[model samples]
Target: MMKLDPTNLHRIDEGPPSKLQRLIRRSRRRRPSTDATSRMAARLASAGVFAAEAPTSSGGPALLDGVRAGGATLRRLAFGVGGGALALVALGAAWSAWQERPADRMSDAVVAPTTADRTGPSALGTTAAVDSAAVPQPLSTIVPVVSVDELPSTRPGLVATSSTRTEVRSSSPPAPRRSESEFAIIKRAQDAVLSSPAQALDLAEQHARAFPTGELVQEREVVAVEALARLGRKAEAKSRANALLTRYPRTPYVVRLERALGEPLSPAPSTSGR
Candidate 1:
């Protein structure tokens, strides 16, 4: 309650604030400005660092380009494989078709008849007896049948008496010495050997049944035997040779057949009169 001098009291009341007091006052005033500054800094960082890079080109073209390149490569590979497979299939089918075709169809006309020569007697031999009708006219003209005594003894087994003229002893003409079809097949098969030995073998086998007792049967057997030997089928060649010897002992090819059988034929003696 003691009254001090007025000037001294005023100086004491107006004295400078302490450091801790200045800090409290300054914090209160700077709160809004600090918040605004923080917001500005956050906006700048987001714009510079977080924004997405501008696209150089749309992704559609890049994706489409990759797809196109892959598709082109795949298409090329598929086409190559498909074309090659198709070619192989086509070639196989063509070869099969060729193998199935008849040998005669592939041969020339003149050669076809020669192949027929290997087939035995015709149906006419079985049905009709030899007479003037069966006798070949040219041979009969050259050697008239005035009597049976004029006929050659070496004539083949088919002969018949004429009903019209009993005294005229005419014989049936010889059956064609060969089959037209068989000859054609054989000729073609022989020609085929020049190109394909395997095909020739197939043809020979197919035609063997038709010429069982033909004049050329022995020759055909020889051809078959040779073909088998050339193919390195020694067993088959030997078997064929044995069959030929058994069936046609008088075959001219007996020497070759015997040789193929591993037993060489003895040489024919000199025919000169000593």
Candidate 2:
């Protein structure tokens, strides 16, 4: 080959070598030895381990501090929610208490009826007078005029005039005793109310003949009223109840009869009969 000019052989200001030439030169370079490669890998692994184990710049335990901060924040939130719920419940209870206050006050302020209420018939036609009349006549009559002097006296003085009067009255012939036949008839009438209402009617009619004006007669009439009603004699029952109410308006049984008849009777006694 001709002697190559230095300028041509050794280029000075040329751009980088072509891609193929650079690849060829790199392929010809010596590769590292196996031991040297392993040593280099160990050094790199040690550096990575040192970096992983390094302390934080903030001079604090980052994970533990973060966990403590989160726990404190959660506790505060829980406390706030619990307090709000408790406040709401307390407010609801307070509102309910406030709403009931007026009703409680009204109940406390209401007045109950006094003894004067016993003087007149109730809404259902009951009065102290009617209750008194239901007892046996002698006891009923004596209750209204009760006096301490009427009682058997322990003192020997003053002659016990009231006691003497009571004794004399007791010794006198008792008021005409009720006839046994009439009593038996009235009792039969009462008994017939459940078994034979028509027979009760017959017994009541017989009682009326014997003891026309007896108080027991009125009771028998009430029994007869019940029997008639049970027998589906509504018209007759109503009529008899009205007549009984008219005749003995002050009788204690009138209210019960009126209730059975499904009507309200006049509270005052009828003037025409009594």
Candidate 3:
């Protein structure tokens, strides 16, 4: 058992209370102890220099982000590039289409050489504008091609001569065989058929000699038959018409040949003569 002192009961000890003043820290600005200075400092390990730059920041901000951020940037760039390429492709296609169009080609009509010289970009623009503004003409009215000599002379002294003859020739155009078209030979014959039947027959004979089985063989036969009838050779015309009808049962030349001969190639369906 511990005994209590009679004097300590009144007081814990003999010492009075001391004042609690704030004590300034001695090592705030001072160097550490001798033992601490002697010991090795906590330092980062020397990294192996694989490249000039480290994974983390060196002195400045880090450039290439890790996989996720880099991939995101790359994706954005790829999308942008792809979009640009698509735009370029569409633009190029449109340009090619515009260039290939036949309507964009210069008109076949002979444009009289303009008095003013057209040299610059402005000339192209002006020409396009004029073409756009010009009203379209029908194929029959619109001359496809004309030479300078064939066109009427606007110059004072140059007289427009009647000798400037124009010729247009047609046939049921099949595939052309030669450079000199079958139309050329038949055209002359067709024109002369009305006025000069003898001449037309001569031309037809020429055509037969040149193109034995021509594309315009039907037209040639029709012309020959007409010429024969016009020249007062009914027997020859009838014989030729019969032969032609036999060869081509549905020959379109029947109407013209029948009219010229003033009779049917095949005998007319005999009416009810009862």
Say which candidate scores most in TM-score: 3
Off by over 4 Å in 1: 1-180, 258-274
For residues 50-133, what per-residue lDDT tens digits would candidate 3 score against the true structure? 112334555331112221232232223223332221211112113333234434222311121131113211211223322321
TM-score, candidate 2, is: 0.31
Q: Across residues 1-274, which tens digit of lDDT does each residue of candidate 1 receive?
A: 8587776564322457777667766766753322223223222221222112323245432212322332232223223332221111112112333234333213212222232233223321211211211232233333434446655589765354444134453344345433334434454454454356577777777677766554345545665775676677877876677676666565555654554445553333132111
Tell me the spans in candidate 3 whose CA falls farther than 4 Å from its real position: 1-106, 109-179, 267-274
Tens digit of per-residue lDDT, candidate 2, span 30-148: 66532233223222221232223444456553222322332233223223332221111112112233234543322211210121133232211123212222222343233233245
Q: Name the regions of candidate 2 deviating beyond 4 angstroms.
A: 1-180, 266-274
Candidate 3, pairs of clashing residues: none
> What lDDT, from 0 to 1, does candidate 1 have?
0.41
lDDT of 3 at 251: 62
Candidate 3 global lDDT: 0.44
Higher-lDDT candidate of 1 and 2: 2
Please report how far candidate 2 places residue 268 from its true position, in Å: 7.9
Q: Rate the local accuracy (lDDT) of all candidates.
A: 0.41, 0.45, 0.44
Q: What is the full ranking by lDDT, best candidate first?
A: 2, 3, 1
- Model 1 scores a TM of 0.30
Score residue 113 of candidate 1 by CA lDDT. 28
- Which 10-residue window in model 2 sums to the lowest lDDT? 107-116
Native-referenced Cα lDDT, model 2: 0.45
